[model samples]
Target chain A: AQSVTQLDSHVSVSEGTPVLLRCNYSSSYSPSLFWYVQHPNKGLQLLLKYTSAATLVKGINGFEAEFKKSETSFHLTKPSAHMSDAAEYFCVVILSGSARQLTFGSGTQLTVLP
Target chain B: GAGVSQSPRYKVAKRGQDVALRCDPISGHVSLFWYQQALGQGPEFLTYFQNEAQLDKSGLPSDRFFAERPEGSVSTLKIQRTQQEDSAVYLCASSNRDRGDHQPQHFGDGTRLSIL
Candidate 1:
């Protein structure tokens, strides 16, 4: 079975400052990874994805993530944070050779301060 | 794009009542998925469909949970004898990939089901 672990339950950052949300995964086969953001009472929106196509993946809303196979980690990053960035984020993994079910991390709540 | 759409934004059911949830994926998207998310928790996979074929249902909690994509487009998830523990947001997603992708899943706003 595959699983994902989010390093933090919450992360607070100041607007115009850098931001990071950490995630790690365990899978028997090469995994496909994704980051999603959920605003309060809203549906989740895709942030970015890594499918072995690129190590550095860029996403919407000025967000990006690096798929580090050696570290078994995929962390989301932004050069600068915006107050609207405050929301919940999820790190997910899909094993290459399974039923293609997504294994998701518990989640990280991001708080952007003005 | 219209993304994905789920019906009955909110649902309330008494214990033991049967309930049905619906999903409409993006036009021409052959792969569809269903997930269940508890409050403050990541969504858990419930099932997957490719066109009219039900490819995977391993994640569905029990046999009481059944999902089908009748015409390879709109889908419905029926849960028999709903329980309080069944209360959660049911999310539906779709992707362009036929067998499914490791790519991000496009999600619906979700059906918030409450059991009282």
Candidate 2:
């Protein structure tokens, strides 16, 4: 079975500060990792994904994540945070041989302070 | 259409009543999925469909929950005898190809089901 764990349940950052959300995963095989953002009363949007191709993946809205095989982590980061960035972020893992169901992390709620 | 679309953005059902949620995946999408999200929790997979075939449904909570994508383009999730525990947001997603192929899955706005 594959699973993902988000390190923080909530994170608050001042506007213009660097942002980071940590995630760890346990998978029996190579895993496809993804970052998704959800705004209030809205559906989730794909931020970025990591296939076997690259370790550093860039996503929409200046968000990026690096896949670290040794650390068993895929952490999302942004150089500067915007007020609009306040939302719930989730880390998802899909195992290679599983039924293709996404294993989701508990989710990290981000708050941007003015 | 433009993306995965779920109907009746919000629904209220009385206890012991039956309710059905609908989803229309992006045209040409080959894989469709349903998930349930409760308050303060991440979305959990409920079922999956490949084209018109129901492939996996291991995540469904109970036998009272049923899903079908007979024509493949549109899918429906039906809940019988709604209970308070059934109140949650149901999300529908679709991918361009086989999920194992590693394609990104697009999501719908979701239907908020409230049981009273």
Highest DockQ model number: 2
Off by over 4 Å in 2: none
Off by over 4 Å in 1: none
lDDT of each: 0.90, 0.93
* TM-score of predicted structure 1: 0.95
lDDT of 2: 0.93
TM-score of each: 0.95, 0.98
Q: Which residue pairs of candidate 2 clash?
A: none
Q: For model 2 chain B, give the 10-residue run with minimal summed lDDT.
A: B96-105
Interface RMSD for each predicted structure: 1.5, 1.4
The candidate maximizing lDDT is: 2
**Alpha-carbon RMSD to native, per candidate:** 1.4, 1.0
